[model samples]
Target: MSGSQMGGAGWEKLRADIQKSQFVLVGEDHGIAQIPLFTAAVAREFKPAIFVAEVDPYVAQAVAQLVAQPGPATAYLRRYPEALCFFDWSEEFELVRTLRAQQVQLLGLDQVFITTSAPFYAQLAGLVKGKVAKSYFQRQANKYQAQNQAFEKAGNDDFAMAKQPQSAIDSLGLLTQQEGPAAQKMAHDYALSYTIYQKQAHQLRVNLMKQNLVQALLPYQTATGPAAPKMLFKFGSNHLARGLSQSVKGEFYDIGNVVQNLADIQGQKSLHLYIIGKQGERAESDNPNFPAKRVGTYTVAENPELLPFLSQVAGPAWSAFDLRPLRRALTTSKLQLANPSLERTILG
Candidate 1:
């Protein structure tokens, strides 16, 4: 993708696009320290009434409570380390602080119950608990050990012959035709394992939806005006897909499915979804696919609107913004937009 310049006019256009929308989804590339700055900038421009984060409600509630108290915002970081996993502390703190100052309600969209253990245990129970699940896990361990031993032997032979690090050679060997069958077998086994894990994750996601719906409805239930103009949902692209689908094979549910289910239960069609993703990286087959198009690039001169905001936060000196990095960011933002196909399914 070519790096194009976005000027003040471009920023205004982007702001206009955001203002006209009822929902804005911002997808991100890899979890980099700078990504949150862009998120905050966009949020500042749009000023959505609600900011939905990937963090679970339990953590969000705790953080929200902490924000309500008067002190350095960084103080809350020490209390909840896991919440920092999604974004850098300083950027996230700034975003949270700014949002709170503006009185924008923060909503937690992730399910609280979907722990790593839940899926493993659920699968274990399905496989017959102590008898089948334990045996399966043990067998899996043994198989991995054998593979590791073989890989080590191959690495040793390559290193001995070439007198260099065997990492690249080892990686190449693993991707060769000889390894294809083994890779397929591993994939199949992973699928089976994932099936068990997904059941538990799905259950947790459903529970989260129930809780979020109740919370979001409270204000509307009490009174009614035109209703909030827009909502901004910030989350991993995976959950925003057509349903609450995990990357685990058959276990994935596209966000679309979740929305349809919600509409069926609520008897409402007022919600609008905007899926967003950033560009810069090539799309991986495993990643959630979306109807994506280039939305231009972010250049230092073009987005001068961001200059003041970026300056306020500490970061690397701003130079010419590379188109590749900006594209990657935009591609991610596009993916966050709710899938239109899923939306159609629900509305129809």
Candidate 2:
């Protein structure tokens, strides 16, 4: 009902909603530091018949193989080239380890549409093929001018106050609007080339959905009487919507979109959706209003059980590995789960 209650009370309601509905889709804000913990909590609470993540299917398959055959977390981390910069495998690996320990079914939801090289080539080809489309060029030019005007306006407003000049914002605006036409032409050409890629992506997406659904539903399909009441799908927020918000009708087709499309294709009409976003300076007010409850915003705390394992690996270096040492200290000293009251309430 309120922002504070969104994490705990809202999550409890979400679990309940998932239990009674045919499907539940949880969307997440990107790089939300709290998401790993939130996801781990949801998996534990609902013990959802199935769990999925934003990981690509190929990567997922690798993860599945690794999950099935337990090994060092480092081995698993090596598989993802994209994760090297910020994500240490330990954070997510711990969740995978926990889920496997709990015997939860995990699925990866990303489907690759085109090989990375081909799309780059196609985009380059499109840019060289013609005089940049006139309309596209004009739109880009107008966007550049408008952005410049906006920066000047913001600067003027800030200057009215007796504050130090906000050169950073002004500088960033300059950087963003520089090379207006060439940038626009490149972007438009890339988009034009991407149209071909999108068709392939869509087809791959459909196939991946069909495959995942078949596997997820296999248990129920083989069972007699009324099947299990519900399922929880964990995927990137990107996959939850239809597509980028800019495209016409493209706004409607993500994993949630895929689910709806599947339901329509199969003539079913009853599934529920639940999405989660991280709390930030922008505030929840900036988020889109979907027809679901707002769960509370939470920050991730290290799972206590994980520390001993980490300690074993890092040895004398354990302190370095434990980023939130206070949380870890509280967890270890208290000999308690973090936020037990909230956890119990949600699990209940």
Candidate 3:
């Protein structure tokens, strides 16, 4: 596989190509911190028109609005931590701050809420009125209370139904036949489907998320914008990869595939950049002054083969290493990433 280090003239080559892309999906290992630092640099250089996030669209939109209005970023985020829980204090926060500083647009595409959906559902329930819808809402409210009571009596923590309410909108047709206002039925149906099937449900949510993302980015796909609608999708590896996911069932259409298909249909270009962590449990370096050692962050766990090359990676970050020279140094070398397919998947 042909690869280039991120610095020197190498970064210039990657930047030239990346800046031309209409849609760019960058994969991440979620819990890692250094990944965001690399991404921040990319965003600064790439200056994509918009950032497509792996968060709830509704909450993401709200946060985007908040970010655009001004005020402290962290304070605003902490005020409504439920918008996208995982993104709260993680490197995502730094990403958000950086993008906001660059005046980049933020669009969240996921439908699932990390915490309880009751708050959002309650708002939807309030928008309509009718016997069926009211009854459905009342019943669900009572059911939630009973469940909490049961857990209290049993000396257990109250469990929440974290599932999305997409089915309720579908159920409106059936509920309306029960002889009530269509508006009420719509609300009632959505509330009823707030149950989880775990794996299948998660798969469905991700598929729907792709649709949401494509729809959200469709307008920006036009020939306008400062530079042909450059967009960056920062998501988990499973959500951004163009390959099968053992985590989800059925035919999974991840965000990357969705964007790729969309770009193809529109005669545009997209790139899937997957970033992987080291393959093993390599301890953080004890050398505090090591230039590559990130402050308060773990070091990339190098695989056995990369162990010899690990010394080449400085403390600042992987973005600093131009892997091209390293690769040329050893023709027999193959990247031993946690995601074994990454090197072949991209640089190949």
After TM-score superposition, the amount by which residue 199's alpha carbon in candidate 2 deviates from its true location, in angstroms, is 7.2
Tell me the deviation in Å of residue 325 in model 2: 42
Output the better candidate (1/3) by lDDT: 3
* Model 1 misplacement above 4 A: 1-12, 68-80, 83-88, 113-200, 221-229, 242-248, 251-348
Q: What's model 1's lDDT at 261?
A: 52
**What lDDT does candidate 3 reach at residue 348?**
18
What tens-digit string does per-residue lDDT give for candidate 1 at 162-240?
Answer: 2213352243233332434533333233333244334555655545554564566566542433243356666654455
TM-score of each: 0.44, 0.42, 0.61
Please list the Cα RMSD from the true structure of every candidate, rounded to 1 decimal place: 16.1, 18.3, 8.8
TM-score head-to-head 1 vs 2, winner: 1
Q: Identify the leading candidate in terms of lDDT.
A: 3
